[model samples]
Target: MIRSIIHDEMFLSVPSEKAGKEHLQTVQDLRDTLHSVRERCAGMAANMIGVNKNIIAVTMPFGEMVMINPVIIRKAEPYETEEGCLSLKGQRKTTRYRKITVRWQNENMEVMKADFSGFTAQVIQHEIDHCAGIVI
Candidate 1:
């Protein structure tokens, strides 16, 4: 289902819980919601749709990818940039890494890890921040 974008700062500030196999539906919802807003948004976290699960959907060059319980294991080369969120009023300045290595689960609940950089990496870092309850 395509869920509504949450704008409540208090709600968005609370950290999301780890996702499990049972949260598969939330993953689908994230994908659906992300696709629905693809024109203006490149990524979305589960909390953005009002679900407090550590799940995020990102639009890659090939297609949309969902990351469950994503964790940034390593990051390098930080730089400052501004970003806008569908759940927020305007863009905010923040520091982001040029490269990041993440460990997460796929839709099937299988573990996956990979390195990402440039814009893709920046988008992942932003979504992960949502999981951590950090608004930037």
Candidate 2:
């Protein structure tokens, strides 16, 4: 189901966890919701749909993919940029890393690590912050 974006304090305060086997359905739901809104959004987090799970769907230059239990392993050079959230009313200035190395799991639960830069890095960091309950 495509859930509506939430903005309540309780919803933003919820802490997400590493998505396990039990969260496969929720992950799929996030992915579906992401694709459904891809025309207007770059990515989405589980919390955006009232599901407090560490899952996000990001649209990269190559394609769209889901990141499960994503964590930034490395970062470099902070930069400020205006970012908008689907669950939030408007854009805000947020500090983001220029480049990042992220470790996350795939749909099969296999761990994967990749270095992301530019816009992709920004998107990943923004979604991870949502999982961390940092509304910006």
Measured by lDDT, the strongest candidate is 1
Please write out the lDDT profile of model 2 over residues 94-129, one tens digit for every residue.
999999999999999999999999988999999999
- Go through the candidates in order and give each one's C-alpha lDDT: 0.94, 0.88
Q: List the residue pairs that clash in candidate 2.
A: none
Tens digits of per-residue lDDT, candidate 1, 1-136, equal 9998999999999999999999999999999999999989999999999999999999987878999999999999999999998899889999999999999999888899999999999999999999999987
RMSD, one per candidate, in order: 0.7, 1.2
lDDT of 2: 0.88
Off by over 4 Å in 2: none
Choose the strongest candidate by TM-score. 1
Regions of candidate 1 where Cα sits further than 4 Å from its true position:
none
> Cα lDDT for residue 83, model 2?
93
- Local distance difference test, candidate 1: 0.94
